[model samples]
Target chain A: MNSMGLALAILGASISALLAGIGSAKGVGLVGEAAAGVVSVDPDKFSKVLVLQLLPGTQGLYGLLTAILMLSRIGVIGGNAVELSTAQGLMFLGASLPIAIVGLFSGIAQGRSAAAGVGITARKPEHNGKAIIMAAMVETYAILALLVSILLIYNIAI
Target chain B: MGTQYASAVAVVRTMENSLFTQSDLERLINARDRKESETLINSKNAGTLPEVWEMLRTFAPDSKELEIILYRNDFHNLKAVLKAMVSGREPDSYIIQPSNIKNDTLKEAFRTKDMDVLPDYIRETATQAYELITTTLDGQLMDSLIDTACMKAMQESAEKSGNDFMRKYVNLITVCADIKTAYRCSKMNKNRDFLEISICGSPELDKESIIRATLGGTENLLSFLGNTIYAELSGLLKENPAEFEKRCDDMLIELAETSRLQAFGIEPLISYYIAKEAEIKNIRIISVCRECGADKVTITERLRKLYV
Candidate 1:
């Protein structure tokens, strides 16, 4: 029964990570396309746009951290298997949901910002640093959501 | 009075509309022929200068002044400089815009070796700013104080206006001022007066903090974060002033993009103003670069992307 509970919690984390990361992957891919368009115009602007594109990739990192934390809860890291009650399983699901959903939307939003940044860079190359910083601002909330999920998963007990 | 103010806005709107477009800016930046570039600039200047003059007439019909208050401020400083040269005095030009203190009056007073002909108000203002320059132990002290006071005034105005454009412009100006001050302080390696004369509205980032944050440009100093996200964002570029400015330009672009996305009524007007200003500056840059015979690569790097 303990192993079964452990299996469900780990499964929850994996599913959340998959959903969150897919959003991030799509986001970064969109920004990358925008960046490629900008670079085609002026090769020198490559490094600047690259930073803006990298902002969306942070969501993936957050999701991966959530997965790792969830696995640790199941004692996949340092201890024997710990089983979570059904309540704990629901808690894990609730906590991860915010990150997954917010991460998806924010990631897409970041891509839009990156596209704008790319447009600016095509004209004002120096503005790249500022562009990346602005996109990063939107990403902050998503990261905060990721942190919430990690803390929630950590507090859960079998 | 309401009609007058409305007309002023209308004139400004019309002038804003007539400003050089993005395509004009690109043409200016890319122009290889000197005569052609000058023709473009002169024609643009000719077209806008009259509109601006007309607007000023509409604003203060009787006065009909040709002066740009800000640009004249630069002229006022230049007058201070010329007077100082004639009188064997070192005066601070930063506190008062050069054109404000009556250029002809200052020159006349200086020419006669008498400061009395200058208006009492102008003389008093110049004297206070001058004292800061003359009494200070060195050039460094004077520069910091004047820069601080200007930055402080700008910050206060920005805070007071609270309108999005005014606030953002003020913040942008303050951040740039911070970068300039920090750059000066780090290079001179001055320690005692850094905080004393630093701009009040900045987020405090110390010398080690700035060096760590910017990675290369400045050394020991403090940075004060203002009441905006741009303030903290500025810290990341505290090390490289130029890079920080570029970042600011990008932030403006982001703001413009967001405004476009939201389809806010006022946003387009503001964005067009910014973009047009960038266009004008880019043309000016091209003119200077061409005159100075700077290479294409160098000129391109310095050109604001929006304009060129």
Candidate 2:
């Protein structure tokens, strides 16, 4: 119960959620500020800008999902209770780092790209698809990071 | 590319679809009558000249960029007031009352002869121009004083604003004005002293060399112009002075075209404002020509490039 491994695992999971969530929040907020400008002049564009506003939000969900998976793996969410060694805990923390770091940076980069994409739609609403595509391109690195985090966590011995 | 301008740029881009196109200008050019042309123009924007000016005012956020644009109008009003002071009566013409310096302030300054009421930038030029006109009754001398001041104000404001696009704009404006002055002075057979008083330029242009070349006459001036970026202008100046004048407007429109593709920064807003101004100028030219039964060639010659 007093295992340092459990503490490290929890800390790692918490960071995975915290950093990614913060990054997505900032990214979404940036797009929202830009969207507000267009919407002020043309309120008809609310739906289009709203779509763009949500693009950066995916990172937060990815973070939450990774955190949940890690929590479950660590027996914190109704699983076989096994106290972990410090090395095991540190390994879990290391496994969580991919998503925590990459998700944070990629989410922000995605948000900026999406904000710029929102500008395209604001100017040419018919080209919203292209704008969406442009923003979505930034999601690749984030998805790769998510996969690495999941793969590493899944393969780590308990 | 500042984050603050993101939204402003977006709104401007959305508004770009509403701009008059080159084909739209052609339609105006080929319109059978003035009424048809006016109908075509009103259909697009649905506003008079004043409303168009209003859009130009709001399109730019209230920043140093907007101030730079508005300064042209401010100095033009200064010219109007200074000219009226000598005329002993205000002309019933539309004077551009800028945001910083209002029409009332301009009129009051003219009436009171009070430098205190005027903005510090223009106070000296206004005083100098007023004294020159009153003492010698030289309208041209007064105009040169004001013109030099206007150019100086433009150069300072553009430089101080620290916008690269604006700095380029200032250079284009300064070089064009210098060329026009040199051309006019050469045509008049004026000397170095007159060129010193009349020609104002930016660091981008070598005004002294230009003045010296201009001292040698139109051929030397043309040879000097041939060596600069304005080499194309020399041929136009030789072929037709009117067409040469159009190059300045075209230069602005060309630069604005680059802004049309831009999705970020204050440039889109700046370009849109200039584009709208060009649109208005073209429309006015077409309308007046159609009303007067002037030829299409005359109207087309004066028409500026379209933003769209």
Candidate 3:
């Protein structure tokens, strides 16, 4: 492993994080807007809708963790900075692909879910807790993607 | 035929046949001793209580069936009240039953969206419930839409594969929904235009019988429906409704068991969700009983057999 390879791995990890972040940002934005509208009418509902809107932000956090792990793998944190060969760099890149793609799409879908939750809360507020819990359950898959990315970066030696 | 399809049908059929007989339901429900009633209810898995209640509701309207429905209703009422209280709305006037709403309370709650004016309990539960609702956006249509989609999917699955299991499953479910709705509409006949929603499923009885069975038991709808079904239910109220609902549950449980015997694991899964819902029902029941100071023996006796 050389500095060039390590540099490539760093780039790959950054790209994955950037992609997931973009998705999460967009999703959270969409849900936040709808939640804001709902809150305008029912100001007391701030806590519930806010929590729901925040859920999509988890992907971004997961992506950031993955990027950090990728950097650490290159010995970027310790005294000696290692590098990766082209093959090793490509492997790291490929490993991050799954999370990047899944994170992007699920984030948007979850936003729509947030909107629906908003409507339900507005109509039958009593059912809101169970409703949000169900939404959170859907967010689990996205977090799983982050986990896989972290695990992949951890295993890489670049 | 594909082995998978054939097996599924065989399992469902086996379950359909083996459900609890009328006598079995009576045995559990009509126990002479308090111990016997408590034993029947206590022995059940608390979780399966809701689905058990649903199964009972799907069965034909009868006295025994009504008791199970009432037991289930009691849980729902408690949940609704609690939920309403948390939402900052006085639950005292909220409609606790699905088809029934407390006309006055509903009007009051629906009129204003202010949380400050509501009682502390209503505010807390409502806020919690509101949060949950905002989070599960896609699930907004889950309750009513899923029922429709489930029927459609079952019908399609049945037609393409010649699978009677899905057919039977769909039939039973459809009948259940129809009866529930019809009973609802009949009760709302007082303000028929405002209360009636679209009716879509079976149990295929005339409008009169459906109204007769569901109207009397549904609380708070009496003033609206006038003097309908009240006389009949009051006369036979104690034993029949509970017995009938137990039979329905027995049917579903039997259906699931039959599928298990036939190695159809999925059948049990269906029962599992239903039973899960039942467990929630039981929890609410015990909580409500505790809150309302209902006699322990009476509350215990009303509980259904557990599924899982």
Top DockQ prediction, candidate number: 2
- Model 1 — TM-score against the truth? 0.46
Which ten residues in a row are the worst by lDDT in model 1 chain B? B1-10
- The sequence of per-residue lDDT tens digits that candidate 1 reaches over residues A29-99 is 76676566455435666787788778888777787788877777777778776667777767776767767
| Chain A TM-score of each candidate structure, as shown | 0.89, 0.95, 0.89
Local lDDT at B281 for model 1: 58
TM-score of each: 0.46, 0.89, 0.34
What does DockQ give for each predicted structure? Answer: 0.01, 0.55, 0.01
Query: lDDT per residue, candidate 2, A33-99, as tens digits?
Result: 7788788778999999898889989988889999999999988999665688899899889888888
Per-residue CA lDDT of model 3 for B22-130, tens digit only, reads 3434554345565775675555433244443344334223322123213223323434544554466666664444322233443344347444543332333333434
- The positional error of residue B64 in candidate 3, measured at the CA in angstroms, is 56
- Residue A119 miss distance in model 1 (angstroms): 26
Q: lDDT winner between 1 and 2, please give it.
A: 2
Sort by lDDT, top down from the best: 2, 1, 3
Better of 2 and 3 by lDDT: 2
| Residue pairs in clash, model 2 | none
State the weakest 10-residue window (summed lDDT) of model 2 chain A: A75-84
Least accurate 10 contiguous residues by lDDT in model 3 chain B? B1-10
Summarize candidate 2's per-residue lDDT along B18-130 as a digit string, tens digits: 77877888887897776787689777863444554465456554677666766667777777777777788773375874346778888887678787788776778878877
Residues B1-308, model 1: lDDT tens digits: 01122223222333343456666756776777877787777776534433433334444543211122233253346345654654577665433622334445555554575667754324433445456555653555544555555555544544554445545655555565556555565566546446456543444333344433333334223343333344645465555565666566656655554444321123333454455546555677778887898877777777665521
